[model samples]
Structures are given as structure tokens and as C-alpha cells.
Target: MSNAIDRRDFLKLAGLGGVVFASGLPGFALAAGQDEFYFVQLSDCHWGFEGPPNPDAKGTLKKAITTVNALERQPDFIIFTGDLTHTTDDPAERRRRLSEFTQIASDLKVKTVRFMPGEHDSALDNSAAYREFFGATTYTFDHKGVHFIVVDNVSDAGASMGGEQLEWLAADLRQQKTDSPIVVFAHRPLFALYPQWDWATRDGARAIDLLLPYKNLTVFYGHIHQEHHHMTGHIAHHAAKSLIFPLPVAGSVPKRAPLAWDASEPYKGLGFRGVSVDTQSGQTALSEFTVVKKAQANATDKT
Candidate 1:
């Protein structure tokens, strides 16, 4: 399948109680008869965020959790890419937000939920508080027939994955066959999407070079606060949308500020994503869900 997101798929939304699958991804061939498993990705929730960009910031995260719980088919697990909470200069407040975010996330019905840090959660203090709440910054695990790698670029504060982590990644990849299906979870874009806005990881190109040999590699990341798809050779990079609020496209304006709230289009560009992997055919389906439907948006507009 082509890497380009189909126009129809990009425009599709998860209406009140619906999920719309996007075009399938090619080259992930698993053995015949293997069952399909999917996971939900909720990124950039920014739990403590409160501002004009999202008037209902406090309620959005809970709504997303409710939506995921209400899915007809629950995911095997759920992963939050990054920015779990808004930045706070006070270390005490930071821990409080992290604790609160964890408490709320614990309500997720899935068996396993994984998390990584965004700059907002880590940069101020090298992820000390985040690590106190979450675990290792970089790690790897295997699910069924696929290998998953979680990279930490935000911890460095310089937006680089760092040499030690790079070595760890290289050693880890050495154990897997070049053709093994691999999925990487990260906070920032590995490639230079827009360096001016800090969208690109400083030393991410090196990590990308290390991952270049993998045949069925895909990356899911969040930081830009929008849904974006890109390619680095054979690897596909997908950026998830934010649950807190949406930001303008890369370089769309002179600044990287969050887009203002539109009373008429409440929750317009805010939601989570569902990624389904078909082991038999190696096809992956992406589904986008809005936090609120038309009626809900309208109702919230009145509030």
C-alpha cells in the first residue's frame, strides 16, 4: 500500500459512536491465520492545560477515556505518546499533575497502558519526576510477532535521543532480523519536519539511520499536536492528534501557538487514534475518533 494517507481517510472522523478505518498499510506480512490485534493511541493530552485553546481542557481527557472504554472492541492495550500534563515550573505542582494524570488514566479498561514523556513532562528536570512516576525512558518489548521500541528524545532537553540510548537501540535492533516488523513510539518527529519550531529531533537522523535497515518499520509519535504522515525510506512515521487542543500545521503561521477555540467547531481537531494490525496480511488500519460528535459539540458550545 502507498504511504500517502488517502484524502478520504484523512477526512474521515469517528462520529459519535463510529470508527472509520483508513487504507491498509502494506509490507507487514505475518504468518497465515494469525489473529488481528489493535491498540489505541492517545497523545498530547496535556492534562493540566487550561486556556482559550481548549475551554473544556479538564473534561477532554475524561471524555477520551470514556470513549475508549465504550469502544465495541477494546484494544489489547493503550499508549500515551507524550505530554501527559502541562508544564509547571513548581516541582511540587508537576508531581501533582503527574499523579493526577496517572490516577485518571488508571480508569482505562485495557489491561496494559504504556507511557513516555514529552518535553513538557521532562525537559525541565531531565525527567526525574516523570521517571519517579513512569519507568525507564528507553526500552523495548515484543507483542505477538512484532517488536516495539520506545525512544526518549524529550529527556535530553536538547531534543536528541542521546548517544547512550542510540547504542542501546542499536544493540536491541541487532537481535531482530532485518525484516522483522518493528514499531517505534516516540514524542517528537524523528525527521526534520520543521526545525524552526523545534519539531525535529536534533540527533534523530542518527537514530533513523540505525532503523533504516528494518523492512517493516513504522513509528507513532506526538508533539506537533496534529495528524501527520511521513516517510524516511521504507519506514512510515505517523503523528497523532492532541486531546487537549490542536495547533496549526507546521510553519502555517509565524508562531507555534495553539489554534484558538472555535465556538462553532468545538473539539474540531482534537481526538485520539486506533491502530489495528492484521498479522495475516501485514496490513494496518488507522481509525481517527473525535472526542465529541456534532450534537455533543453543539451542546458543549452552549455551555
Candidate 2:
């Protein structure tokens, strides 16, 4: 199968090569005989954040939890892509933010929640604090006939998944069946999204090479703080929006930063994404929805 995204768009978003990679719609739908599982993808909460990026970052996270709790059909599990806390080396600060994040989960309606590290969460000390609070740098699990791989793509300085993680990725995929539907979760996009601003993964090409043989694969990530999709062969790579704030589109500006919202509608641009996986048909479908915070009650009332 050819890559899903066009060469021009890839160059524009990735700011690297203008050469066409490949082209074809990779199958994400379930195969003929398998059970279906659905899940939610949330990213970049920055639990310790306290700024105009969005007033009351804590409240916005609470709103996210409430929204997930109220989903009409609950997901099989939840995956938080990364950046659970703001930039900080202080263990106390990290602990506090993690505690707050965990509190939000106390009322969660979903049974499982998986987490990965973002540059911000790991920048200070190889994610020492985050790992202490969470667990594991990278791991894999199988559910209902599908393979789920979570990778530690961020380095101590906020770089992409480096040599060590890539090696582990190759070994991990070697054990899975080629035909099995694979779902990879990470903090940064694996494909070249924009190397200029550190949006693209450093050694992502090697990671993609390992997955090229798989007939069915999908990658879900957060860190770009927006919703975007690119396809490479049979693999579809998606970046989820941040729970705290949104960023400008790739290359839209000289540099990327979270866009500030008007106080009246703080949660205006915040939302979560839903991914439905059907093992039976071997298909994965995505949809996004914004959550209304308590402070946005009037806005919701108006709508």
C-alpha cells in the first residue's frame, strides 16, 4: 500500500522532503472475524500549568474527566498520550501535578488508562518523576486479538524517540503476527510532521520501517496539540489535540505555541478524541468532540 498523505503536503507539514513517499488508503477497518474495542485518546493536559494559555487548567482537566464519564457509550479504555505535567525538575512539583491528575481519574468511568511521556514531562530528568508516579518507559499489551504498543518517544531534553526505544520497537513488533491489527501510542508524531519545531520524531523512519510489513496498523499520538492525520503505507498516524490549549497549524507561523483563549470561553478549543477499533473487520474510526467546562455553562446554554 502507498502512503496516505501526499508528498507536497508531507513536505509542507514536515518541512523536509518534497519527494512523494507512497500512496494508498491503508485498511483500518476490522477483519472478517474478531471482536471490536473502542477507546479515547487525550493528550497534553499540563496538569501543573497555570497561565493565560487557559484559565484554570485544573478545571479544564476536570471538565475532560466529566465529559469522558458522560460518554453515551463508554470506551474500553483511555490513553493519555503525554505531558501530564508542565516543565519542572522539582520532584515536589511533579508529585503535586501527578496527584492532581490521579484525583481526576478517581471519578473516571473507564476501567483502564494508559500513559506515555511527552518532552515537557520528561525534559528535566529522563522522566524520572513521571516514571516514579506512572510506570515503565515503554511496554506492549494484547487485547481481543489486537496488539497495542506504547513507546517512550521523548528524551530528557524533549527529543523524539531515540536509538534505544527504536531498537526495542523492532524487537517488540517481531513477536506479533503480521496480519494482526496494531495500535501504537506515543507522545510525538512518528512521521515527519515538522522537524523545524521538533514536531517530527527523530528516528521515526526506523520505527516506520519496522511497521511497514504489517497489513493493518494505526498510530495515535499527542504533543502537537491538534488533530491531524498522515498515512504511511498501511499505517495511519494521527495527532490528538491537547486538553489544555491548541497550537497553530504546521508552518502557519514561524514558531509554535499554545493559542490563548478569551476568558469567557476558556475551554473553547479543548476536546478529546474517540477511536473505535473493530477486531472483527480490522477497522479503526476516529471522531473528536469538545467538552464544556463549568465556566462555559453559559456558552453551552447559548448553544
Candidate 3:
């Protein structure tokens, strides 16, 4: 198939609202009729979270799963970037939330699902519970023609990847050719968006230095609880929308608290996204979908 993707084709692939960002596949090449796949990215579900920011916290994740299942085309896989559950002092409560989140996510029709940890999920216990539920916090895997690396920035108390994981990342990057298409998943922004609100990784700059040598690299992350796009040299960093509640933009307000729930817009800033990767051209598009449909939002407004 040709690398070119038309708008209609992209919408059909996403089956939801999308604002496309077509980044050229610089340095990576694939022959005609090569691998082209799309995946769903849902982040910061914060299961067990209950408050004014989201009264329907318990139901939002399930709604997202149902929406994904209703998609016109099922994704090749699904990945949850981080913050699978809200933070709790009680270990038992944390595990309970993780278990519940996993059970609900299993309803997805997709075959493969990947996960990582956010500070809320890993910081308290250093990911002991998260590991028991998910696998290693940091690892690398290849899908089709793309190289994917999951980094653990939340497991460390300092919110840094730590020296050991940094060494591991460097060793892994050494194995790849410069032309390889690399995608990174992390819980926090790899670049400093705003440190005042803790939106940035403590030692993310070191990790970026390690990644700067590559010609084709992109980072998908969460924890900011909003859709954000940034560039560090040629590498692109995109943050997914949260499944629980949305937060104010970096330094937008005095604090980093979640945006207040909108009565008129029940699921306004809360939703998940679908990422489409065209291996032939090395282009990726993101489609954003709300947790509830227009009718649902309207009904909530009427009530």
C-alpha cells in the first residue's frame, strides 16, 4: 500500500474525532505493502479516585473501554501509558484498584495490551504492587517496523529514571541503527514543560541526550492529564489525555489540580486517543475521543 493516508482513510481508521499531526518519517524506510498499524492509548485512569473533579470516576474508564470496543476497526494493540490507578496510602487499596482496573480493561476487544506506571501508581511503593499487576516498569519491544521503549521515571522517589535505568537505555539504543523508527512511552514529560507543578522529569534531560543521536524518535507520555505536543530537536513528544480528569495547562494556574468538572460538558476534557502509524511513510496520526457521546453529555446536562 502507498504511504499516503487520506483524511477519510484516517477518520475511518480512528472511528472518532481527530486532529491529525502528520510528522514525516525521516530516516526510516519500508517497502510497498509493509506494516501499517494503529493502537489505542489511554492514560491516567486514576481508578478509585472520587471527588468533585469527576463524580463518575468509577464509570469513566469502563465507558472508554466500551467506546474502544465500538470502534469501526479494532486496533492492533492497546497501551496504557501510566497512572492506571489513583494513589492510596494503603497497599491493599492500591492493589484493589489495580486489580479492578485490569479487570475492566480486559473487556477491550484488542489482542495485545501494554502498560507502564505513573507516579500515582508507583511512587508510594516503588512499583512493587504495579509490578505484581503489570510486568517490569522499563523495557523495550519491537512491533512491526517500529522500536518501542517503556521507561520508568515514576518508580524512583526522585521522579528520575535513575542511573541504572539510564545505562540500560543507552545500551539498548546502541543496538538500533540511526534510521530506526523509535517510540518512547513514559509517565511524565521527558522535557521540562514546567517544573513548578512537577510536570517535568527530574533527570529527563539526560535521557533526551541519550536519544538525541537518533534521527527518527517520538515520545508518548501522560501525567500532565492533557493533550500536549512538544519537540526536542527532531524528536516529538506527545502527551495523551487523561481518562479520569483533566488538569490545567502547565503553570496555567497557581496549582496543578484537576480542572473542575463541567456540568454542561460532562466528559469535556476527559477521553482517550487512537494512534495510527503508517510504517510505509513513517507518519503517525492521533484521534481524540470523549468518554461519553453527544447524547450522553446532553442528557447529563438536562439532568
Candidate 4:
């Protein structure tokens, strides 16, 4: 359970042979006063990745933590969408980078942090290393009557949910009450956003097909490194900006690349989002705020 709650209502969510967490999950009794809750969503930290798009890449994630901690209201938890670290084929380097990321993120004021892997973090060796650091790439959890499904689409040879995970998702949904609000978090866009950039998930259509039956569903993902709003039928999907760098809008150029850094306003296309749920009123509010503002980012770039 989150630190915001008085008592943890443990629930079982099936995936990776069906494990139980001390935190929220399906079948867990809703906590008292759970009608309203909020959490932060961060993505594409790329902790060990360095590139020209972000001259101050080293301090990217540290700045995010400081910014989140200073929010007007502390969130119940923080959910990192994916790409916790940059991709590296070297196994030892992968472990070292991920471990370092864990340490830096631990500095956050919020303790209930959920992690998934992006292709950069999980595409190597079928996500074996990612699982070693963060358990269960895909699973379901509940918070304030909301059913949240965290899916793994960046592993298994490419950005695809694959057959086994699809089956698990089906079984999980079958057990949930039909009217429950559903929110999905994945690293890749579930729909075919842009195949040329390797932005689309190969088998995402099948996943969306399964979710089409639900009355209330939404997906929050991180990969494109920009703010985007898309819809697959009634389900709303939104992508959050990356802490590292921003990629060009899909198909805007012949190939996908990080947008040329706006030197005049460094860190212009970078920020994090806060998502709040209001169960009694049946609504959610999302806000995007920059982690490293212009002045702060400018100073960071100098050092």
C-alpha cells in the first residue's frame, strides 16, 4: 500500500505466475477516504544516457526528484513510465546503470514508486536484467477504486506485448468488475503511431482489441518523448515528455531523432505529469510541469 493510506489492503494480481504484493492490487478492499487520490508520472529518465539534445543529462533525474518533492501537494506515489536507464548491450554495464538509477530515484520524497522498462532498459536478453532489478514487468494494481494495469511492451525482441502477456491481461480483466475505471501504463504506444521510428508496438492492436470491451479505459505511455493525445476508440491515450530529451513529432522528418535542442530555452520540451483521481466526481486531472525550469536548467548546463 502507499504511504498515503492508513492500512495496506493487499490484493492478488496475476502475471509472472501470479504473485501478491504488500501494495495495492485487485480484490484489495478500497481504503477509507479513497475517493480522491493523486500520483506523479515520470518517464524516459535515461539515467546513463548522454546526448547533445540534453547537455545537462547527468542531472536530469536528480532535478526531477527535487521538483516533484517541491510540489504543492505531495503525491500518494510516483510511477516511472519506463526507460529508467539508457540501453547498453554490455550486461555488467546494464546492471551498474540500473543500480545507480535505483539509488538516485530513492531520493524522492515519495516512496511508493512503480517501475516498468522501456526498450532501452528491457530489450536486451528478454528483460532478464530489468526483472532482476524491478519485479514483474506487467501486472495490475488498484488505487482508490481505480484498476491500473502496467503492461510490458518494450521487451520480447521489440516493442510488443507478445502472446503470453496478452493472455495474462485477458484473464486479469475477466476478473475485474466491468464498471471499474481502468488505466494502462506501457512503454510503447499500443496503437501504430509510427512504424518507421519503431514507435508502434507489433502486437499492440491485439491488446487494444482485448481492452475494447471495457467501458472505461485509458492508456498513459512514454516513448516518443513528447506530449501527445491519441485515442483508440473510446479509450484515451496520452504520452508524457522525457527527462532526457524530446524526439521530433512522429513522421515530421524522414527519420526519428531527438529534436534539435532549443539552446535559447534549454530543456524546453521536457517535463513530468501529475495525475489525480476523483472517484466520487468521476474525473481525473492531469498537469504537466517542467522539472528543470529555464533558469535552473541554464545553470545546470553551465556546470
Top TM-score hit: 3
lDDT of candidate 1 over 191-253, digit per residue (tens): 999999999999999999999998767899999998898888877788999998888998889
- Please list the C-alpha lDDT of all candidates, in the order they appear: 0.81, 0.73, 0.81, 0.78
Error of 2 at 227 (Å): 0.5
Candidate 2 lDDT (Cα, 0 to 1): 0.73
TM-score of candidate 1 on Cα atoms, chains taken together: 0.88
Clashes of each: 1, 15, 1, 1
Error of 4 at 77 (Å): 1.2
For model 3, the stretches where C-alpha displacement exceeds 4 angstroms are: 1-19, 22-34, 300-303
Evaluated against the true structure, the overall lDDT of model 1 is 0.81
**Each prediction's TM-score against the native?**
0.88, 0.83, 0.88, 0.86
Model 3 agreement with the true structure over 1-303: per-residue lDDT tens digits = 355455446545434322254333211112224366677889999989997888888788888887788876677789999999999999999999999989998998886999999999999999999999898999998888888999999998788999999999999999988778788899999899998888889999999999999876778999999989988887878898998889998877787788888877788898777777755334567667777676766564321
The per-prediction CA RMSD against the true structure, in angstroms, equals 6.5, 8.2, 5.6, 8.6
Error of 2 at 269 (Å): 2.5
Candidate 1 residue-pair clash tally: 1
